[model samples]
Target: GDSDRLKVGELVASLSYPFGRESSLSFGIISRRGRSRSVSAGFDFIQTNAGASAGSSGGPLVNIKGETVGMVTMASQNGTMGFAIPISVIKNLLPRLERGEKIVWGWLGVRVSELTLEAADKLGLSPAKGVFVNSVVAGQPAEKGNILPHDVIVAVNGVEIDNPREFTRMISGAEAGSEVRLTIFRQGGLLQRSVILAPRPQESGGGREG
Candidate 1:
């Protein structure tokens, strides 16, 4: 019964006010969920194939039972696909929005990629499935914590990391000034370090989390 959670292939519909056309119904289904597109601070969106026209956003996307599941955010450049911010995210930020507070994003300030088998072999890792640190932004949490480039992160707070999304998920939930423990693989050795997170800078951009 949770509106925040949805399954792939689930039936979904929208009531849009596209170009001032209110109450216009479009039929479609959830193509995917928990999709994050890079933007300011970034938010996970529900991917749908629901047809929408100009101004379709600011409208409600509903489930079969007429529950408002999401709100249209943008259409693809070619209008072939649509993205909607999950209502759960809005609800989570509503309190701050209501209080007229600026939204803050958790910042780790590190760019990462998936560990490839070749890289694993180069790094002497077997069966590599961990996240690889590509770069670290200076003056940010990762850099401040001495998370150098080429350090392969294997875990966070004792939880094994399998991909970049898991890494972002862990950091996104963290508050500024909160300390996080990271397990890193550097030069054929495993090391652990504690990092204190900071709020994302005003001009920062979010990375895609699929």
Candidate 2:
């Protein structure tokens, strides 16, 4: 995803009650984007100084006209700043909640790491960006799709990916039984493959953490 989805200068609004009386409006911007550095394995979060509070929990944080973006959940005790899960990710999760369905992830059974310049060059890649497939499970999607070790994935479903986080993010967004197109650079050439994503088999021994 790109910053275009978020309009920084636009007034980001939220409902709050400083004294827990009645709902009051507060505003901020897309202060920052990306995950909280402290959460080792969480989706990207939006950082804002909007007056979120405990009483305001579950209230929609939105744009000026109140286009739902996120729920007011946390704030700093010292009134320094606050955090929010981005609307892009929220839009993906709320539907499941409404359906009373649990969130599940499709596992590829691969342990990948971001490729460094030297490592990418060793693999004959023209550019040194994206995640490198370190290993793949014998019978998982990575293996089934012939995602070879050392392959540098540059995109998923036509979306350009430059890191392991983005790679996993794109895959997680895809629905089970649907197909995803992958762009990979291997040896000295580029390759494209379509993988029919399957729900991570619960019985499978190998898996990715959800």
Candidate 3:
């Protein structure tokens, strides 16, 4: 199945060996689409109500026609919700893995969160948009480029962004060592910064890149 064509409310099934038992199938609908949570890296996830357990990671999430649409990756602690990595993500990674090439994710070295209406008002932004920089890692590209905490990143390379996930995806898509322009709003002023991205470290500290 074309995962891109998947829609919310579509019925799907997750196949996995929960608790080391024999292969099991759980049914549910796609609860949400294109969710990028803090815990997962790279691609956004397909949120589902399907039952997934500890042993369900890496199992196939199929549609009504038995076509693999996603791969079960994680679940909520109470087992009420599940998240699946879209098959499109696997499709992109498979070629690299097969060729024995290392998957290099670009890093900006800054933690960011969604900009709230209150924060936007405080920042004097007419529209409540852009991601708010929570912190900048010392000696990293963002810090080196003078990105400070509380700064609001309005755009990347002139492309306006509205959320941390969008910003993260844009940064990760760029090649390492490439310089990208950031449009920022700070202290009721606008500015731009050119920062050279670095390779993402093996262990990330928090959400929204870096």
Candidate 4:
């Protein structure tokens, strides 16, 4: 089944062994599509109203035609909301996993936040776009590349971006040690910076932002 074809309000079911019990099915509709990567533990997920519990993670989320569209990942404490990693994401990683390759997340070493309309106005921009750099980790790629705080990242490799989550996805998807061109806005002027991404560290410490 095409996960990309899934839409809000579409009926779906999840098969899981909650509480270590036998596999059971929970029915629900797609409450939301395309959960942000930042909020979904670095993977894009779809929000469902499906009831899931402990031990439900890694179960299949099936559509009406009995096609697996996603994998159950997590549920809210109250069990009212659930999230599933879309099949698209799984498909992309399957080949690499099968080849025994370790997943490497690209690191940028910068903390960023949303740039609101008010902030955009003060910056003399009409439309609010891009992410505002909050801090740069010392000795990291961003700092090494001369990316400073107060700079606005508007594009990556010439592709316009307006959301921090999107930026995270783009950077994390890129291979480590690859050079990327960043278009930044600073002091009402636009400039470009080339930064070579580093591999994400296992233990979170000095730099962790993707």
Per-residue lDDT of candidate 1, residues 1-210 (tens digit): 244578889888877866764467888878867443332334455778774556778778888988888888767667766777777767766787899976655777888888988999999977796789888887888887899999998987776777775576656655566667889999998999988778866676454221
Full-model lDDT for every candidate: 0.73, 0.64, 0.80, 0.78
Each model's backbone clash number = 0, 0, 0, 0
Q: What local lDDT does model 2 show for residue 205?
A: 29
lDDT of 2 by residue, 60-137 (tens): 677666576666655656664555556666665777779998765555657778788889778777667778888877
Output the number of the TM-score-best candidate: 3
**Candidate 3 least-lDDT 10 residues:** 34-43
TM-score versus the correct structure, for each prediction: 0.65, 0.62, 0.73, 0.70
- RMSD value for candidate 4: 4.9
Which residue runs does candidate 1 get wrong by more than 4 Å? 14-28, 31-59, 72-84, 154-183, 188-194, 206-210
Candidate numbers, best TM-score first, in rank order: 3, 4, 1, 2
Q: List ranges where model 2 is wrong by over 4 Å.
A: 1-5, 8-28, 31-60, 71-104, 201-210
lDDT of 4: 0.78
Ranking by lDDT: 3, 4, 1, 2
